[model samples]
Target: MGESDATIVSMILAGDPRGLNRFLSRYGHMLAEYIRALTGDDNDLFSAVYEDVLVDILKQLRVLAGTHETPEIKKLSGKGELLRPIFESAARTVRRRFPDLLKASEEPKASPLPVDDLAAFANSIDHVDFKTLLEGLAGPERELLVLRYRLGFDYAEISNIIREARVQLEERLVNARHHFRARLFASQQKAMV
Candidate 1:
């Protein structure tokens, strides 16, 4: 797996068109899907957003070309591991613009989100009780909660971010959410008693 990861990155960085072509052919659609999900699923804007994601990923990789990070990158588990940080950055910057961009794309037909909605969202998770409930969860479960509830990433993005299959992510998220809710309920009952 490490060899394949290194080979894939090396192919992209070695200035070999075949390597680039092969890499793109293998992962292009998947990356586009990741960007599309992050970009509000606007079909018309998919091309441009996908291009930006690819460029950002390539630029980040090129920066690693000569650095000591190249070997470490190779050691990553797979393509998803390589792309997790890039997707996280995009989720932070690009996804935040969705309400505005989607509205604009639809000729301002779509309703804009309230200005405070995002702040409210981030604050919704800013609580000790929520953090305590999260501690009872496993690593992947806890990460899924933070990624979905706190960062506002959907299951697709979380799937890629955590390198889990979408089906598996969905299952884990459901179980984790249910468990967390039960804990919260139990705590509330205790407080009242």
Candidate 2:
């Protein structure tokens, strides 16, 4: 956690209104990206989910800050422990309300690239190819990548949020990366024709 994060957490704990604003400013983009990745750019769903997440986070601020105790909140430390719980809570709420959004894994089809190509493609990824390839990924893979890279979450934190074992999460992430790289390689190959 940085000094700004500590200060924001402290302000929220102290019941300052500006704290919520600051918190929203800090995390709003990440939250937006998370919701979009999950819901596939459905603006209506995104807006509703965003509002719901904000409200939920605000309601639980005191508990998360450790001013009030709950089983979930009890595990939090005072420094910067509030963010994960808040994000996880919002994710769960969104998932519950939009179960259909989680069906990304049901898509049929596999990458054409063989296993040997994965490492090379991953190493050669450039920004343009990365975005194009990322969009081609299944929803779960995209979500996993976004959470790990964009959100700066470790495997442990991701496991906690996604409710999977750390080892399983790591395996899934590895596979997702392979799938993304393979897709990028295939696209590039096609463009050369």
Question: Estimated TM-score per prediction?
Answer: 0.44, 0.73
Model 2 lDDT per residue over 45-107, tens place: 778888888777777665455653345444444545666876787767767776666666643
Q: What is the clash count of model 2?
A: 0
lDDT of 1 at 78: 59
* All models, RMSD in angstroms: 15.0, 4.4
The local lDDT score (0 to 100) that residue 32 gets in candidate 2 is: 86
Candidate 2: pairs in clash? none
Backbone clashes in each candidate structure, one number apiece? 0, 0
lDDT of 1 by residue, 137-163 (tens): 544455566667765678887877656
Q: After TM-score superposition, what is the CA distance of residue 17 in candidate 1 from its true location, in Å?
A: 1.6
